[model samples]
Target: MRDHTEFDSFAAFCDQSPWAFDDVADVRDVSRARLDEYVAGRTDFETWEEMKTRAAEEEIIDQIVS
Candidate 1:
């Protein structure tokens, strides 16, 4: 896994990019909400596959929009 510093740097880079923030907020919000649901035992995906799939789809959409 990446260290916090590396993640921070990557986030900084994203913040600087024109492709960031605008759609990221919505995507992140949805992802967080879904994650919270899972954490609250409302779902049953022992792994992160579902979350990852949603994130990947969102990312693709973001890329297309950008």
Candidate 2:
């Protein structure tokens, strides 16, 4: 089994959320609390907000390097 981390949450979030990056409209309107709980269970992040913040930083760094 692969061990998931805070950075991993973003991909998982995107995969589960079909409307994740939809800036025009908010789709897949699921419960925020439910998403947070799911992320917390799979990762170290306690909240979905926290997971995004931290994971985004890593993604930025990766892009810069790439």
Candidate 3:
């Protein structure tokens, strides 16, 4: 497992990336056109699959730690 510092860095990465917060209600409510902008590299990730994979990994790691 990564140390707290690594986790903190990952958290910061998420904070700065639009794809990292897609589950937020306001983010989900955006129009398809707006979503396309983010998915097309307005943020760190280029596609929903990449973001989803990262989110799922985060969830799995959280479960293991908890």
The per-model lDDT (C-alpha) reads: 0.45, 0.61, 0.54
Summarize candidate 2's per-residue lDDT along 23-64 as a digit string, tens digits: 423423657887777768767778777866876787798899
RMSD of 3: 6.4
The Cα error of candidate 1 at residue 54, in Å, is: 0.2
Residue 31 local lDDT, model 1: 58
**lDDT by residue (tens digit), candidate 1, 1-66:** 022112244346345433335553544544555445542342233333563555578679889999
The C-alpha stretches of model 3 lying farther than 4 A from their native spots are 1-37
Best candidate (score: lDDT): 2
Ranking by lDDT: 2, 3, 1
C-alpha TM-scores of all predictions? 0.32, 0.55, 0.41
Instruction: Return the top candidate by TM-score.
Output: 2
Candidate 2 — which residues are off by over 4 angstroms?
1-3, 6-28
Clashes of 3: 0
Q: Better model by lDDT, 2 or 3?
A: 2
lDDT (C-alpha) at residue 4 in model 1: 18
Candidate 3 per-residue lDDT over residues 1-66, each given as its tens digit: 133123345445346555556445545665666565555553456555566577789889889999
